[model samples]
Target: MRITDLNPHGGIGANSLFVELGPFKVLVDAGMSPKHEGNEAIPRLDLIDREPLDLILLTHCHLDHLGAMPVALRNHPNVPLVMTPASRVIAQRMLHNSHNVMVRQREENGVRDYPLYRRQEIEQMTGRIFPLAPDNPRFFSSLDGDTMTLTYHHAGHIPGAAGFTLEYHHRKIFFTGDVLFDDMQTLPGATFPREQVDTLVLETTRGASGRPPGYSRDKEVGQLVQAIRETLEGGGSVLLPTFALGRMQEVFSIIHRSMGQRQLPRVPVFASGLGVDLCDYFDQIARKTKAVDFRRQILKDLKVQRLPHGYKPGQRLPGPAIYVLSSGMMVEHTPSYIAAVNLLGDARNLVAFVGYCDPDTPGGLLQQAAEGEYFLFEVLDKRAMLAARRMRFDLSGHADRDELLAFALDLEPRAVVLTHGDPEARDWFADQLRTARPKMQILDPTPLEPVEV
Candidate 1:
C-alpha cells in the first residue's frame, strides 16, 4: 500500500491524502487551509493533475476537510464523491458559503485566485456523489480484477463526520478523520468498530496536551456558565469566539439548556455569519437523520440577534449580552476580531475560549496576553489594552491523546501512520507509541512524500 500526504506546508492545514492500493487510486479529502489564502491554501493537487482517481472521499463537511472538494472534482471530473448522508446535505451549504467567503476575499484581500471553483462546477458534480450508510461496505473494481471494499463509521466530531476503512485482498486499512469519543451536549460520541486491521491511519490533533487528572467536561461547561453569569451580573458582556461548524452550535445548545433551567439569565444573545445560517441545515439534519440535536427553534427561543453596527474600540458597545461569533481563530475582519477590539479595553467584560486556538492566530495571541498588555489589532490598525478577563474551557472537539493511543492499540495494526496535527503533537504520539511498543513501525509522513506500508 502507498499513501501520500498532499497538504503542502503540512501540520493541520489543507488536509488531503492520496492512497494507492493495487489498481485502485483514491483521494481522501481536499481541504482549504484557514491560515492561508488563494492557491497557497489548498493541497498540492498538481501532483495528481494527470492521474486517474477512482474515488474522492469526504470525511466531513468542515471547510478544512471539505473546502476544496469542488476543485478536486474539477481536476478529476470523472471521479465519484462519497460521504455520509448528513454530509451530503451539509456539504452543499458549506461549499456555497465557502464560495461566498472567497468572493468577498477576492474584493477585500485582492487574492485574485479566490473563488477557486465556481458554483456551476459544484452543481455539475453533484450527481456523482454517493452517500453510503455506516457499516455497509461498497465495492469498487478495477479492470485488472482488483476489488476493494470501503466502509464508514461514526466519527462523532461534527454532525456528519466519519472514519472509514478500505479492505483490499483481505488486507484492511482504517482512516480516522477528525474524531471525538466523548459525547457532547448536541451530538453523540463515536461508535467505531473494534475489529483489528492491518494498517491504522490516525489523527493526532490533541496529542501534545494531556487532560489533567480529575478534569471533567461537565465541570468545565459549568464554569463557562458561571463565568457568563458573573460577567453579566457585573454589567459586562461575554464574547465566545467559536468555529461556525460544530463549536458554535454546541455553545448555543448549552446556553439554551442553561437559560431553560434558569442557570443563566435570559439576556439578548447575539450571533451572525455562516454559523447562524447553518442552524436551518442542522435543524433539517436533526429532524431527518437524528444525527444531531439542534433545531432552528433554539435561535427563536434564545432570541439571537445580529450584532448592531458601529462598534468602535474604547466606545460604549453592546452591554450585558452574550456574543458568539465565528472564525474561532479570530481571523482579521471576522466578527469576533472586531468585537474583541471593542471589548478588550474594558475590565467589566469577559472573553471565554471553549476550543483549540492556534498560536499563530489572533485568538491564540490574546490567550497569551497579560491583563494590562496592549494588543495590536493588525487589521483595524489599532492597539488596545487587554483588560477584559480571558479564560479557556476544556471543550475541545478532538479526543484526548490517551484515549486515541488506547484506540490505536485496540486496532492492533501492523503499521501506523499519523496525520492531522502539529509537529509537536505528532511527536508526542510517536514517542508514546514507541515507548508502548518498542518495535512497532510508526510512520510520520512528510508532506507530498509517498511512504510504503
Candidate 2:
C-alpha cells in the first residue's frame, strides 16, 4: 500500500490524502490550502485519469477537509464517496460557501477567475456519496479482484466526523481524521478499537506543545460569566465571535447551562444567520439525547435573541448584553464583524474570542489589538473612533498535545504518519512521540509526496 499527502502535509489547511492499493485508488479528503488557486495545489491532479479511483472517504465536512470534492469529482466522475449523513449535509453547505469565497476572491482581487468546480459539479458529486453511520463497515469496491472494506469511527472534531479503518490487499490502515482524545466537553467522545491497524495516519494540529492544565467546560463557563458580569457592570456589551456550526452550538449550550444554574448574568444572547441554523440543528440533537433533551426546552423558554443580517446601524443592544455572532475567525462579512464595529465604539465594551482565530483573519487582528488601537467608525455623517480591548478565551474544538499523544498511544499502530499542521507542529509532535516510544516510526511528509508502506 502507498499513501500520498496531497495538501495538508506541510501546511495548516487543505487536508487531502490519497491512497493507492494495487489497482484501486482511494482519496481520504480533497481539500486544498485556502491560499491555493482553484484546488490545484497538487501537480499530479492533471496527470491522472478519472478511471483509477474506486472510492472516496471523507472524515468531516469542514471546508479544509472536504472543499475539493467537486474538483476531485470533476476529474474522477465514477468514484463513489463515503461520508456520514450529517457530514454530507454540512459539506454541501460549506462547499457552496467555498464557491462564494472563491468567486469573491477573484472579483475583489482582480484575478482571472476559474473555479475548481461549479454548483452543478458539487451536485454531481453528491449523487456519488453514500452515507455511513458510525461504526458500520461496508465494502467500498473490488479492484484487481481484491475487495476493500471501509469502516468509519467517530473522530469527535465535529458532528459526523470520523476516523476511518480500511482493509484491503491483506493490509490494514487507520486514518485519525481529526481527534479530541479527552471525553468530549462538547460533542460525544470517540472510541477506536485498538487492535485494528498497521498504518495509522494521525494529525498534529496542536503539535506537541501542550496546553496548560485548565478547568473543564463548566469551569471555563465560570470564568466567562465572571468576565461578562464585571464588564456588564461597567456598562459595556460583550461580543463573542464564534463559528457557525459546532463551536457556536457549544458556546450557546454553555450559556444555556450557566443560565439554568444562575451562574451567568441575565443578558440577551444573539446569533447570526448560520449560527441560528446550527442552533436549530443542536435543538434537534438535544431533543434526541436524554441528557441534553432539556436544552431544547431551555432554549425555547429563553428564546435568547437573534441579529438579522440586515440589522440597521445605530441600533442599541440591550444594556449589559452578550451577543454571539458567526464567522469565528473574525473575518469581515460575518455578523460578528458588524457587531464588532457597532460595539467597539464603547471603550467599556469587550470583544471576547472563544475559539480559534486564523492569524490573517479579523478575529486574529482583534485578538492582537492593544489598549490604544484606534478602531475607525462613522457617526451621524462624520468620522468617529473607538478604542477597544480584545480578550481571548479558549474553547477549542481540536485536541491538544497530550490528548494527541494519548490517542496515538492507545491506537498502537505499526506506523504513524502525521498531517494537518505546519512543519513546526508536525516536527514537535514526532519528536515527542519518538522520545516516548523510541522504537516507533513516525513520518511527516511534504505535500503531494508519496509514502510506501
Q: Assess each prediction's global lDDT (C-alpha) against the native.
A: 0.91, 0.71
Query: Which residues of candidate 2, in runs, are more than 4 Å off?
Result: 36-44, 183-186, 282-299, 312-318, 375-387
Model 1 lDDT tens row, 1-453: 999999998899899999999889999999999889999999999999888988899999988898998889888877889998889878988999889999999998899998999998878767988988777889998877779999999999999999999999989999999999999999999888988999999999988889999887888999999999999999999999999998899999999999999999999899967899888889998988888989999999999998886655445566899999987888788888888888888899999998888888999999998889999998788888989999999898889999999999998888899999999999999999888878778999999999999
> Compared to the true structure, candidate 2 yields what TM-score?
0.89
- TM-score per model over all chains: 0.97, 0.89
Query: Each candidate: how many clashes?
Result: 0, 1
The reply for model 1, stretches above 4 Å from the true place, is: 309-315
Instruction: Report the error of model 1 at residue 139, Å.
Output: 1.8
- What lDDT does candidate 2 reach at residue 22? 70
